[model samples]
Target: MSFQQLVECATHGQTRASYVCHHLLQSGQDGSMRPVNWVRDEDEHVNAWCDECEEYLQSHGAEWNDKTEAFAKIRMICENCFETLKATNPTKELT
Candidate 1:
């Protein structure tokens, strides 16, 4: 699908912008990326860390870190793109 179509789908659908420490084009484990839905207050501050990060955070008493940088690195993607990435990274699952 075209980029325009992807944007439209992502915007029109409930798909929200998400952030990942690594590039979305790369493969990652399940729940590595976290979706940010502005429409939902609960989703705004929701922790989006992967299992490893979460564990580390819990261990270090730093469960909540500044997400500003991570948010800035986020690139909006549509369901199609999301699905494509999922297929590409068979071992990873989108949260």
Candidate 2:
């Protein structure tokens, strides 16, 4: 998807511009949602994550696996939320 479309998806169609990461849906320290850096290898595309999420994704998987390509757009998350998700989904894998 184009960058514009990704922005729209992140803001729920709002015109406000922001970056968003595909993994966890939360704003960064700046209090604005932004797209995470992406690492693409051939057909495999993965969204970068914060330190905690990075460990989780690395332990599990890093490939983009959202059912809807639109939702596949990435966003950042706070450290607290990262720990929460990691604790809640101990066995969850991003595939």
Candidate 3:
């Protein structure tokens, strides 16, 4: 079994920790939940974003810089919630 670190989430109780951009945590255009696109980070955390953000990333040569980081409001969520998002929303290949 893959064991991840657990932390107390006010909503999900004790759960694994995961991170994503604030955009992925919010509703997309027209208030619809959109797929979360994962960006390859280190093994310690999950870096996910929405399509627009993904596009912005690619336009910048897939590099994180001041411009990209400007709108990227990262947030922490329970792993359970992350799994829910991963299942409910369509996914894009990790880059």
Candidate 4:
């Protein structure tokens, strides 16, 4: 689908812009990825990306002293992007 169509489709329900951002961020990780486990309080399952995205970021400017460090960086970067998108598009407030 076109980018606009993707946006339109994603915005049609209770889904928030942050959710969209998360998907986009993870899209680069892999298209066919899925969560391996579920949480009791959350509606959707929590998941991690394949090694591709992690390796991609590591090859770039991202630094990691250990495996946990890499994971922390990934979470920080994703949250930063999500918040930036949210701040710039107040109309698309995530409720």
Candidate 5:
């Protein structure tokens, strides 16, 4: 939620912070990942998720709750890696 704390990454070293879905934090790409939702907090990257979680969220009223939160399994990540995931993943149109 907040990026006030910094982390040390082997590849990225110390960098800005972000939160992402567990699936989006995976090591390899299966070409199924996408940037479904993202919010920028001033300069912080905030959070992002994939299409699957987006659909789940929509079905669950598109808000954080007990089940949705448990389903998402979101976790902390570095902005650098977040950028990489965003670049490799496409955006899904919700309509």
Candidate 6:
């Protein structure tokens, strides 16, 4: 399964460009959704996350953190999602 497949399955075929963009933005791909001073932070670096990260965050009850302003701007995700997917389905790498 590729990322698109996984997205389709999760979204029940409601996948759209905006949805992809939203997820990508949420996942912090290419630092597209960074804060004003996000790049200035010494520890701030946008790293690409796998499909596991995307799905896992939703499954693990990881909510947005408005206080830190990182969840929305930084595209934070749940690490547990990646761990679970990797442990359960190593081959699929989701589409």
lDDT for each candidate structure: 0.39, 0.38, 0.73, 0.33, 0.72, 0.31
Model 3 off-target regions past 4 Å? Answer: 1-7, 28-31
Q: How far in Å is the alpha carbon of 61 misplaced in model 3?
A: 3.2
TM-score each candidate.
0.35, 0.28, 0.73, 0.24, 0.76, 0.20
Cα deviation of 8, candidate 5, in Å: 1.5
Which stretch of 10 consecutive residues in model 2 shows the poorest summed lDDT?
2-11
Give me the runs in candidate 1 sitting further than 4 Å from their true place: 1-6, 9-22, 26-72, 93-95
Q: Give lDDT tens digits, candidate 6, residues 1-95.
A: 22221223342343221211133444243443321111111232223333434444456564324522233233333333323323433223222
Residue 15 shift from truth in candidate 2, angstroms: 7.5
Ranking by lDDT: 3, 5, 1, 2, 4, 6
lDDT, candidate 2, 1-95, per-residue tens: 33332223332443323322444454423354333333432323233444444544455565345523334454433333433333433233334
When 3 and 6 are scored with lDDT, the better candidate is 3
Report backbone clashes per prediction: 0, 11, 0, 0, 0, 8
Best by lDDT: 3
Model 4 accuracy (lDDT, Cα): 0.33
lDDT of 6 at 7: 23
Candidate 5 to truth, TM: 0.76
Candidate 5: where are CA atoms >4 Å away?
Answer: 1-3, 27-32, 92-95
lDDT of 3 at 77: 79
Worst 10 residues of 3 by lDDT: 38-47
lDDT-wise, the better of 4 and 5 is 5
lDDT of 1 by residue, 1-95 (tens): 22222235533565543333344433334534433222212433211223444444456654345544343344455544454554544233324
Off by over 4 Å in 4: 1-12, 19-50, 63-95
* Regions more than 4 Å wrong, model 2: 1-3, 6-48, 67-95
Candidate 5 at 14: error in angstroms? 1.2
